[model samples]
Target chain A: MSIFVDENTKVIVQGLTGGQGKFHGLRNRDYGTKIVGGVTPGKGGTDVDGIPVFNTVKEAVEATGATASFVSVPPKFAADAIMEAAAGGIKFIVCITEGIPAHDEAIVFNRLVEEFPGVRLLGPNCPGIISPGKCNIGITSGDIALAGGPVGIVSRSGTLTYQALHELSQQGIGQTTCVGIGGDPVPGTNFIDCLAAFEADPETKAVMMIGEIGGSEEERAAEWIKHNMTKPVVSYVAGVTAPPGRKMGHAGAIISGSKGTAQAKMDALREAGVHVCLNPTEAGQKMVEIVKAL
Target chain B: MDLFEYQGKQYFSRFGIAVSPGDVADTVEEAVAVAERVGYPVVVKAQVKVGGRGKAGGVKLADNIDEVRLHAGNILGLDIKGHVVHRLWIERSSDIAKEYYASFTLDRPNKMHLGMLSAQGGVEIEVVAEENPDAIAFLSIDPVRGLDLGTARRWVADAELDEVAREQTAELLVKLYDCYTTGDCDLAEINPLILTPDNKVHALDAKVTLDENASFRHPEWEEFRATETEDPREKMAKEKGLNYIGLDGTVGIIANGAGLAMSTLDVVNQVGGSAANFLDIGGGANADVMASALEVINSDPKVKVIFVNIFGGITRVDEVAKGVLEALKRVTISSPIVLRLDGTNAVEGRAILAPHLNEKLITEPTMLDAARRAVAFANA
Candidate 1:
């Protein structure tokens, strides 16, 4: 019942010959995702962990009828690879490359809208999306995640989710989908975008939103939740008083001018009826408290 | 990533944008020679990355070679917005009848191509655009088709560019887009795109920021980049392959986790004090990185106190504590350091750090208490 991907979803690995793609693909296959095919430019007809590989995404899709693609190309080639997959009619794309150029991402983002409206690109530098209890198409360590419950975890920080999940698992609670979303200066999915998807998913009864400094995405998402969310949401804004000039978490995770700080986001979330957790360790407990109250 | 006006103009010239003939001059003699070559009544512009040069007396009009020398001498050594003026651009002066501004940048997160156009150009268009956002129009260009001439013409016309000025501005738009994409530029701005009294259009000033990620394709830019003056702290951080940014604060922060580093900052402010900088040794924070971080922090005189917060996961607390001790040995700590080490062998780590504990080195039980005590000590 999770959003994005799950057990029955068929997946393709776009750079399957690469180290990361192969590693995550094996894990994805073990997590019950149907590994239909893979694309690795000149590595067609090859088999990676028994999954068939093709030269292009179009060929891979045609041969295996694959719907989703997990792209693991380098940052420099990420946009072009994603665009190629999009052109091939891949519906869901999870790009796991980090440090792509801002202008190149701009072009890819623009192309996503104009050329591939049917495709949903998850990340250029993100910790790919997962639809727990369904399929795992991301880089998240599956052993840490338990396939039960309806809580959605959306965060800009990857390690915080790991910590939060550790705490949640201790409480016998699990997530429907825990998305890292990545902390690049630019991301394909913002907190607001993830929030909308979570809101629409009936399986997700509660949400643990972890945000950091650097941008108004969290503030805007909090505002959106204040007026829209029906589910109990617990928020944690990480970086309230960050060092003046350091970009620590995600590239886009910066506190500048009047937007995107932990305090500002906390205030916004509080106004929206969200129980903002002050400590990362208390996030699961706080969400549990809110769920009990509900 | 920020480029000075002269560098930007050279990049713009590669795109065929009509700009007044100009040359960069570092000395008064060079300025006079450039002005004479351009046939005087030249404009002497300070070559600095920041805006507001016009109001800072960084821009001046010289009617003769003597006046060029006078303006160049005053500007070449001046400082504008913390950037010391090392060079000036001498260009044939254009008679301005009107001013307009345009820029191409990537809108964060949404990751879309952003085009900002303002009829009220020059003198900090950001302020004017903010005060009256309606006056500046924005367009998100589609990446596949790029920016078309029709769209460019429509945008200029919407911004109130006269019929005669439309073609030149439209041509400039295509060129700007080409420069933005091909140059791998994060930002390309032209302020005061002058509408000459003769109806000719010219780009009077240019600012371009290249995307550092795409620098691999531009080997020539490597030299230009090295020549550009950067914050010493940032330069040191970059040289060490560390991601560090200097902030105006008294408490120096060192954290293992990015989220924790940020939370450490929040906790500091919540308790009462400011953070000096955001230094995340990342998951790879070891004795070497820590020692280097200490040196970088020490370089900044603003850092009066230090805070080390580590919630060790994959990273061992004992390892981080060892790194701290190692760093302390190599670097003299005139300011007090408050450490809050938790998770993964924290007790053992604290025991290891016990020997190093003194007036300069302090340990707190939790992040909150550590931040509070650090701020207290910093102010003291």
Candidate 2:
């Protein structure tokens, strides 16, 4: 019933032998995600938490029938891992590695589009995606999210995603899925892509989108919402008071030449009939209100 | 990660792109020496990362040694749009028969490599794109396919570049694309890719932005880091592996993720308090990470109150609580800390902090409550 993942989705972890891979792989498995196997180039034939390991993603997919992959490799190898996942025919790839060079991402992204047209790459520096209760493929805590709710959440941040999920879950508002698209300048999926999916998902009654200052992605998403979206979407844009030309933690969370500012993003969203919240808690409350009215 | 004009020219030269031989100098004497070596008439250019250096008189053509000294003396230590120039690039000036523009940068929306080539070069490309849109030829290069000589030639012709400059320009464009990709640069731009009267094509000015994320792949980038004049706080945070940005405020804030860290800053302001800095401890909320973050925040004298906002997901609040307590023991903080613990193992986390609750160490039940308390303490 979620947008990208559900109960039927079988998962494989790339770089499963690495510390981060093993940690999150076990967590995802515990969250009821179908983590069938893993792929570690040199550490194939080993097992991580009873999960089988293979040398290549193709082998993992062949043996476990895995449809999705979690990329947990180091920054230098993350782009290649994504390419391998796509080449192996993984339908959905969620990369959790941060600090990947933009040029590497640019090459991998172009490859995914030209070669693996059907493959969906989530992030190179993101926390990944979570379909609550059914499957969890990212680093997002499964315990915080409620399953099969009327709300769908998409954000460009990690902890803020958790914050919104906590606020909603505290109010007994469950969600269908929550996606952290990552805060990289050239992330694999953007707000518009996630919003489009949310609009099509019948289970998603209302959507909550969290954005930060950077690029024109938010403004572009606002345009998409104005022209296309039918569901009520509540939103929040962080870094409202951020100083220009300074990067605020995230690589993409910067104001460049007055092009990407919180004020401009908020104005665009409001003009598109989207209720914008000032803070994370208020954003959750706005979503709750919209869902109740719906 | 932005390179100076001199460094950019050096990088371009590595890719076989023709650039006027240049050398950087810090003094008027050094500038004169460089001008003598390069054989004046030289261009005395201030080394600053910002644009409009030419308009600000940071760029001057010096025909003789006296002019070189005069220009370098003025350009060095000269403030151009708030960026003080501490170095100068002296190079042999080129004779420009025509000016063209070429650059390679990532197009985020399309997830592709964008290339802009225009016949109208000396002026800002933005002006060209806005005023005479068709004067610039825009091409989306497939990162995998890359730019070949044939495509470059067609692109040059499409931009309406002079017929004499086509072949060499196309060849140079391909090389520029190589430098853009192989050099691990976010942007490799030649604002004025000029054609001299002799039909020789060369880069007149170079602007490059290195991809900091790609530093691991290029070891030589250490040189770039050496030249960087980073803020002392930023340098210290980088050394400790903490994502920290120093700001001018009273409340010092630390959180586990970038989004939450930023939201913490926003909420702090929303509660009528300003944050002295933004620090993201990432997923590591252990004693070491917490202590390091605290040390960096403590170094900032403007901070009056510290806010520790930890919303655990995969990061356990109990672990963060223990880290906070352990960090408190390690560092003598000058300000009071307001801690907000929520999410996974929040109860256990709060229980761990129960014994440490005091006038200086306070824990709130919610983010809003925590922000309010921190702001109150900051103002008080």
Candidate 3:
């Protein structure tokens, strides 16, 4: 009962001939994702070690009947690739390209909402999703994730997502799906979207969310959970000591005028009956405790 | 990136939005020159990005050449919140019949552009929101359809601006929306969108934040790049293409991603230590990237120990281990290094680092263990 993708989900790579695209695409394929096709505009008809490459997403989707897309194009062209996927009727998209202009993301995100209401885009700078042994997408290492467990994970940061997965795997707990919504100012998917999905899934008994400073998304998620969530949720918000106005690496990870502080986010989550941890290590332990009681 | 007042005005003007006539001056003499050209009864405003500049005496109205020289001399070389005023924006002062607030920013939750307008201006919007929430009228505009004049007119009327000021404010708001969207701005604000006695509406102040991600399309933004006063360590890291932010601490930290790097800082503080900087190698932790990061950290004299934390996802642990070794070979460090490598191919990565373990180089089993060791080294 995994969400988004399972063993049967057919996936295609947008820039499958490029270095990151080819490497991670084959990794996803080798991890048992039914990678049906690949797309490279000029390199259409060519193949990457047998995965068919087409010039457009429309051709790949039609020929392979692929429902999901992994956009690995560079930042400048990433928005176009995502729109192309939407145009071709791909339902779920995971964009792993980082450094995309925020304005492009805003336009593309709204376009998806107005024009392609059915399309779900994950990230422009995310680690992708993995439903344990069932399916793996994006760049998340398939080794650290265990299959078919009670926990569902979501995060904004890539390595923290890996760190959380590693922590959970070490605790001998598996997950239903681990979604990285990316750490961009304007991501296609957010914590709320993933949270709602996790809540609706019967297999996910508990949820663990990893958030950081910048934006009101985490605060909004807290409000939503207070009203809607039934299962126990444990969370971690990074950048506790981050100074104001300083961007801590990721583009969206900045503390702005009195809002988007780690303290504010943590307080909101705690108020929502979430077991907010002080650190990632503590978050894993808290999740383990919740799962044990469950 | 936050634009200086003068730069924001220039950006606003590009989108056909009306703003106070202004010019940036680097020196007091230059300020006087700009004020003379812009005309008397001019305002000399500090170009620092920080707020409270007006309270800090960084803003002054001068009616004549003597007052201009006096105000410019005082404002120049003044420190407002640690930002030394290296420049000033001299503008011709405008008569304010009424003050209003207007801005366009992304509403993250709704995934649309949010426009906030209030008849109550020159004060923080939060104060307006808390004091009289109804005083501010909110408009959500889809980036696709954008804002129209009719919508802007209704929005201004809803915001309860003076009847005389509504039409001009509406027109300017539409232009401001253009500046926000087409100008590639994360935030385009005109705090105190002044309505003059003549019923002319113009931005008295500008608070614009350019989306740095949009730099690829707008090569003209290269001009803003020259205005930054960056920390030397951060400047060095930026050149090497590593995600780095300089901090004041003893433990030098390097991690694989932004979140982990920040978490590393938290863990270090929890273990009774502080991080000197935040450095994210960001998936491509090759020899060159690692060596540059190491060099940047080593340049910080406060750093006593280095902590390299990598949890491989697409980044292979073995590749990271080799990169650390290669980086060590390239940059001679005065401080000990604590390494914690995990995730994909971790066993191979551990084996690769085994031969290099010594007094100067150490490996811990977990993130907490590595943080403790690094903190201990710093205290030692």
Candidate 4:
């Protein structure tokens, strides 16, 4: 029922010996995700809490047949890790690493698109994706999510994405898949990719997209939804009170000139026939109403 | 990390891009000395990071040392768009034959390096893109392939640069592109890239925003810190590893993520209380991060109520609850704190803080209710 990941998906962790990688890697494994192997470059022939560790993604993939990779390397080497995963024949890569340079992301993104056509990347600074009751691939807490749902979620923000899940689950709503596209200027997956996936997934009855200030991503997604989406869509673009040129915590969540404002995004989404809310709580309530009707 | 005009010129020169001879000065005497060195007909430009400097009288043409002294003294204390001009860029001014524009920035939608070149420069590129779309030549260069001299020449021709200027402009564009990529700049811009009366090409003005993320690779970026806007609250928060933006408001906000932090600020404003700052503790709201956040917020005299809104996912609420308690123990908070904790381990989290619930340390189950209480406290 999930768009990208399910119970059948096998995952590998890059930089599994590192603190963040070990913490999230074991956590996801405990959540019933098939975290089969880990890669830590020279930490080969060892096991991190029962998950086999290999020296390279290529070796991890060859041994464990890991279809997806969870990247938790440092920012400087993040792009190289992603490319390594792509080269290792991993179809899906979820990079949880933050602070990757935009140029590096741009170069890697283009290369991935051109050379690794089969690979699907989630983030360079994202919370990663979760398929409720099936498999948890990234760092999102599994407890907040409910299994077997009529909704799919996509978000640009980390805590906001969790908030959406918590709100839905609080209202006794379950989700099919939740994607955090990351707030970086250059994200591997965008709103349109998630929206299109949700549209095609029969299990996903509705979509809740959470966007923030910065970049023309939300507006572009609204345009794509206007022409493409068939399912009911509810959205909340954060940072209405955000002033221009102020980097609002997130690297990508800043209003540049008159572009990427919360107001502009909301206006565009509303114009696209999506129910746009001023705040996240209202957006969740609106989604609940839409889901109840469905 | 927006570089001042002189700094931008220096950065451009690092990459072999031709910019006018310029030097930065903090005092009128220093400005006159730089003008003397750079020669007469110098531009005494205020080094504030804002637009409309000319309209604000921050930019003045000085033909002699006395004029430089007068203009520099007047411009130093000038306020342009809330930025006080504390420094001036004294440069030998070029006689402009034609003004053009060129820049390289990330194309968010296309996921490529976007090169914008316009025949019409010396104006906001957005204005040119809106009023005369055809006048601006947009080039989407793949980051892997990058911009080459051949493509830059073609791009300049497409932008319809003057025949005499195209060759030098193209070569300059290639150098600027290098400064953009290899030099680790977010934006390498030359507004009114001037074609000199002598048929030479050089950047008349520069607007460079260095990529902060790339700072790890460039230890040399520490030199750029001299021009940074000094906000003590922001400086402290940054030192403590917090993502913070100081605002002029009563409610000091702390959240787990940027989106949530911004929303918290908006909610505070909506509840009739303004936000004093936007602080994000990022993924993990551990004891250290929480303590630093509270310390920073407490240091702000304008903050009446510190609103910590945490919707924990990867960051467990129980851990956050413990962190908040630990932080409160470490930092003496002057303002009343209103905390809204939810999501993973929320029940246990609230239970963890059950003993400390009081008038000063308050907890609300939802964000709205907490915001209202915080705003009420701020108003009170």
Candidate 5:
């Protein structure tokens, strides 16, 4: 079984009439995800690609019994979409919109914690999650992933996640689940959250984590891995050659006042007994080695 | 999107917060005129984004017109922390009976708006937090609930500010919170929230960072963008809507995502080659986008070899390959190109490129092999 999503995870699409929503909704459905319905305000009684549409998330959830949602709205309306999903009792929400203001994200995050305690929010600028053969949600290409493998992958990047998944699948290493937590300054799910889930999954023999320069999340994850993780984990931190104080494409990938650097993160992971790879291919190879030893 | 102190003060004033009367000047004559208008005992402050302006002699009190001329002339071209000062903010100096600190920024870990209020101000808050942790009062404000007058009052009292300064400081804090939220700022800081002998409270200095994402809502931000200084390559890339950062190296690197683009840079370094820039095409690998990206990279004269690494997920490798060929036809690039195509129709993509393969255009099978070939070509 995969973590977070699987065949039983019924999904609803937010902003289904929009360009990205329609395109990825069809892709997710094609990948075997149970996209039961969609939500578009004032477009109830409509259908997008054979899926029912409703005026609100609550109505969509009521009609289709959808447990999860994919938020593909514009940045201005993304916070309200997340709130509507939470208010409609969606257990998991994956947001794929980028360029959302940090203050708006702050409000959504605080409301999720105070109002909806058990719900999980994945990303505001990420490529969602894919559990391989079972189901694919969000934007990650499903063909590159293998199902029910011994490895679990979590990353902060979209294309980098694809690179790692492709490398592992080429090496005949399948995955239980691959999660992209996104590259925003504030993400709902972090490395530690995914690592904990991977550690608990009995089918997952090893975990591969992909991080970039920014924040102290990697260092904190290293602390968590040292104390609690029982499975072997390999990791890669991007931006080793990046200049300090310049943001490297990602909003969260800035080195501020010597606080977040690639060397510091790599050193922290090494101290926790984690094998840190220098590049993406090496990261995939390191995961293969750890899984073989297991 | 970091605002200069003068710009931050302008924003604070819009929210009804008290700030010392100031006007920006670009030359010594303009500085003298601003000083004369603002009255004597003006502060000639160099306007730079970096800190330590006072210690770097970019800040000086001018009691007379000649002093204003002298100070403004020196501070205008002064180098503070590697930032050459090109502007000065001339303001009537305030009488400080006490200095306090207050700021609002996002607390990433807690996912809330964090407000820091301290009676110990005028110095770096980091030092206060490190040396006397209890001197500063930290409060996490729910972005939904927001900061009210009662909460601001209690926060001011908890910071142990003088009783005479409490009421006005609380009111100013509420206004500052309004400026922070309604202003769409990532950070709104008053390093020296001062109280004068007359028990008046006002902001002595402002440090603000506006949220660039919120530019859609605030069209007035065009003024801020007009004053920004950026690298030529970065500016061109921004105009082309490509995610790019200029660096001082030889190998120009391009990829599909931020993470992979960064990893490409690292792998180039690991293979004994340095990257000239970091460019992320971001899921759009069509002809126009690829041509624009190539044009931006080719504009940099230091680049000897261009590495185009594409790992197509939602993006198809065939579309990327076609885009690369189409872009090659549009621009005359001096650097040799090393291409790596993988995932989702990679075979078809490679076949599409096989006919175009020559001494200048080369494709590798793997990321490592592609990086090695690119580095070797760059050195050669």
Candidate 6:
């Protein structure tokens, strides 16, 4: 069983009328995702490539038995959309919008814990989780991802996952699922969360984790890997000796204090017994090498 | 997205917080005039988008016109922690009987609206907070309810504000909350919220940072675009809309993936060379985007060599190869480029890039070899 999405995950799309929602929804439908319906408020009667649209998430969930939702709403309204989806009883919600306000994100994060204690949030500015060969729930490019493997790929970047998968595929490596966890400072699911899923999956033999500059999340995850990861793990933390004060791509990719740096993360990973690759291309190769040795 | 003291205090004034009347000046002549208008004992504060200005000697108090000119002239041209002071804010200095501080900001990854209040205020609040974290009162404001008057009052008391300062402090707290919420600020800080001999509180300094995501709501930001003193590389990146940050390394990196770009830097150092910069072409790895990324990298004089690493998934390898070739044709390159193309349409991509192959545009099948070559070339 995959960690987030599976065969029984009946899905609904918020902002189905928007360009991204429609694109991913059509792809998901094509890939056999149980996209039961969509919600676009005023565009209720309209359908996104044959998926029925309702006025609100509550109505859509009640009518179609949708258990998961994909939110492609704008950043301004993303938090509201998540809350509405959670209140509507969507078990797993994936938000693909970028640049959400920090305060709005804080409110939503607090609400998720204080209000909807059971709902699982995939991302507010992240590529959604996917139970590969079963369901694809995020906006990560489908063409690059291939099903069937003992490897699981989790990353803080969307394009990096694609690149990693591409390199892995060239070496005849396939993954159970590849997750682009997004690079926003405030993300729904973190490395630790993804690691837990990869570790639990019997099909995943080893995990490839791609991290970048900013935040102590990678270091914390490295600490976790040192103690808990049952399967072999190959990792890469980006931005080695990067300029101290530059915003390195992601808003989350800033190195401020002593906690978040490539060296710090690399040290932690090394201490944890995880096979750390210094390069993106080597991440997949290292994963293969570890699996071969095992 | 960051506001200077004068601009932040303008917002503070809206919510009834007493702040010294001030004006921002871009020229030396205007700076002198503003200081004259504000009268003697004026505070010349640097107009930068960052904090710690006072510690950086960006803040100076002048009792006369000559001192004002000198301070404004020095502060205006100074670069404090990479943020250049383009303007000087001249304000009538306030008499301080006591100094107190308050600020609100997001706790980043924790995703909480964190508020900090302290009886000891000034430029040294950061150091004090670090050394004595519990000495300052911290509160997490609930998003739904927000920071109410009662919560602000409790925070003030916990921060050890004197009983005499509580009333004016509460009033200032409301203004701070308004600035934080209504202004869509990433940070709103008032240091040295001074208690005067008249028992009134005045904001001696205002620091506010706007949330970049919320720029859509404020159309007026278009008028305040100050790009002159921005890091040339950073400004160029801003223009192209590609996320770029210049580094001191020689290995110039161009990647479609942020994580990959970051990892490429690490790998460059691992193989014994520093990275020149972090450049991400985003999901759009087309020739145009690649060209922009290349242009940005080429603009950096420190970039002795280049690394073009693309794993084509959403971004086609063929497209990236074409982008590299197309960009190479447009710009004269002083540095060598190490290209590693893998993934979808890899055979075709390599073929397209094969003709453009030169001593500078070298291709490797593996990342390790490519990094080694790039780093070695950079050092050479």
Among all candidates shown, the one with the greatest lDDT = 5
User: What's the C-alpha lDDT at position A9 in model 4?
Assistant: 96
Evaluated on CA atoms against the true complex, candidate 3 attains a DockQ of: 0.79
Q: Which prediction has the highest DockQ against the true structure?
A: 4
Model 6, residue B213: C-alpha shift (Å): 1.2
Q: Give per-residue CA lDDT, model 2, range A1-294, as digits (tens).
A: 799999889999997888899999999999899999999988889898799999999999889889999999899888889989988989999998999988888888877887888989898788888888899997999889988688999999999999999999988899999999999988888898899999999889999999999888989999999999999989999998788888888888888767799999999999999999999989988877777777
Over B1-380, each residue of candidate 6 has an lDDT whose tens digit, in order, gives: 66666777776776677889778888878888998887879888887777678889998999998998888888887989988778788898888888888888767656677888888887467688778877789888776678778877887888888889997787678778877987788788888778887787888888777777777776755544552356789899989998887777788898776677776777788889988778877766876788888888888999888898777765678888888888877877888889988766878999998887889789998677889999889888
| Candidate 2 chain A, poorest ten consecutive residues by summed lDDT | A285-294
* RMSD in Å for all candidates: 3.9, 2.1, 1.9, 1.5, 1.8, 2.9
Report lDDT per candidate.
Answer: 0.80, 0.90, 0.91, 0.91, 0.92, 0.80
When 5 and 6 are scored with TM-score, the better candidate is: 5
DockQ of every candidate structure: 0.44, 0.76, 0.79, 0.84, 0.79, 0.61
**Candidates in descending TM-score order:** 4, 5, 3, 2, 6, 1
Which residue pairs in candidate 4 collide?
none
Better model by TM-score, 1 or 4? 4
Error in Å for residue A37 of model 5:
0.9
Evaluate model 1: give its TM-score: 0.86
Q: List the residue pairs that clash in candidate 2.
A: none
Off by over 4 Å in 5: B77-82
Show the lowest summed lDDT stretch of 10 residues, model 5 chain A. Answer: A285-294
Number of the top TM-score candidate: 4
Pairs that collide in candidate 5 are none
**What's each prediction's clash count?**
11, 0, 0, 0, 0, 4
Give Cα distance to truth, residue B35, candidate 3, Å.
2.4
lDDT of 3 by residue, A6-57 (tens): 8899999999999999999999999989998999999999999899999999
Model 1 chain B poorest ten-residue lDDT run: B105-114
For B317-343, candidate 4 gives per-residue lDDT tens digits of 999999999988898888888899998
What candidate 1 gets wrong by more than 4 Å, as runs, is A8-12, A16-39, A43-67, A87-90, A114-118, A130-147, A166-173, A213-216, A242-249, A254-267, A277-285, A292-294, B107-111, B130-134, B256-260, B310-380
Q: Write the per-residue lDDT of candidate 5 for residues B1-380, one digit (tens) a residue.
A: 89989999988999999999989999999999999999989999999988889999999999999999899988988888779999999999999999999999887767788999999999999899889999999999989999999999999999999999999999999999999999999889999999999999999999998988888898888887888877889999999999999998999988999999999999999999999999999897999999999999999999999999999988899999999999999999999999999999999999999999999999999989999999999898
